[model samples]
Target: MAPAARRTRPSPGPGAVGTGPAGEPVHPAEPVPFAARVVGWVLAVGGGIGALAAFVLTVEKINLIADPGYRPTCSINPILSCGSVMTTPQAEVFGFPNPLLGIAGFSVVTTIGVLVLAGARLPRWVWLGLQAGATFGVVFVHWLVYQSLYRIGALCPYCMVVWVVMIAIFWYVTLHNLHHRHLPVPGAAGRGVDALVRLHTVGLTVWFLVIVGLIGEAFWFYWRTLL
Candidate 1:
């Protein structure tokens, strides 16, 4: 036999984590195998927190209704008063408690996360559905944030938790959709999405920081008192 015929195929170098089985470098565009797990954990943890916060807010609202004089435990200060925000018409945008929606949405998110973590590969339609849900959540949270800062003139700690987790869940879900082509990938937009996907953590950190800045600016006077 010739020397070539006797030669075995090459293997990935010592640190070549991205190489395929035949030692070829995988496409940069290919999703990492571990991404499913990361998405799962994010969904599970974020959804769980959002759900718990929503449930607490629901219970607090109920108690407040039963006793108009009741002060919510989360009503820590004038600036951070859950009761004040709860009483606002904005809290029931659909003529029902906003947290009721959170309870339902976040529960589904948690269930989907558990399924993914258990090694279920969800279909594209399912991913799209999650993307739609996350988009709505992120949008709604922003509206609530705006109302809290400007109109309601108070903050709810539990609602803030929902905001944070909704941001995370939306960011990750968007990244996932882009990577898997569940969303369109065209031209410069595609490249931009690819860049975002590669540096997702940085993007997420910056996103949260912007929100923090907005919160700080909105409540700077109160925060200054503590300083």
Candidate 2:
């Protein structure tokens, strides 16, 4: 019989599957989705705009607080009064204008958003940090709204912009955290929040509409009194 045919094996190319020295197979990296990229870009741009707006408003509030008569460049009317809101003790929750907090908080958020938009793959800890910051902002904005409506008896247009933007940022961050499983919420709570988000886009819209309606009603009452 002829000599046994010599055995031969093909070498692996760059695209081929390969084994490590320990004989473990290496897998390829997964691609990120186009929708996620678009969302990142949107968050970056929106966060930047919100941060700039908050910074300007904070500066105006500081000036108004320091000098009561200092007229802001954007003060258009008695109803649209930054000065009225800024002068209130409620504006100084910690003996300083609340917008200062917004300026600092939003600056961090804007930086994160920009990095994400630039294709940075943030770790879980970073996402958790964003969630914590956003939760605090949302709670703080609601507190301001309560003060504006009930205690201060005045509304600030710039303040409203901050409120709305903060709400948007909070919602966006919450959604992202849930989708990426970055939140530390426990089993039942996490499932519940996720269920609410997944099942109730319309409910979220309606909830927002109700908030706007309440604000609109308050504005209508204020306008009626002025008129």
lDDT for model 1, on a 0 to 1 scale? Answer: 0.91
Per-residue CA lDDT of model 2 for 23-102, tens digit only, reads 55555666673335545654676566677777888788768768878998667776677777777778788977777787
Candidate with top lDDT is: 1
lDDT of 1 by residue, 1-227 (tens): 54565665566555555777666855445455536888999999999999999999999999999999999999999998999999999999999999999999999999999999998989999999999999999999999999999998899999999999999999998889888888888867988887887798999999999989998999999999999
Find the 10 residues in a row with the least total lDDT in model 2.
Answer: 33-42
Q: Which ranges in model 1 have alpha carbons more than 4 Å from their true place?
A: 1-31
* Model 1 weakest lDDT span, ten residues long: 25-34
TM accuracy, model 2: 0.74
What is the Å distance of residue 173 in model 1 from its true position? 0.4
Q: How far is 80's C-alpha from truth in model 2 (Å)?
A: 2.1
lDDT of each: 0.91, 0.73
Clashing residue pairs in candidate 1 are none
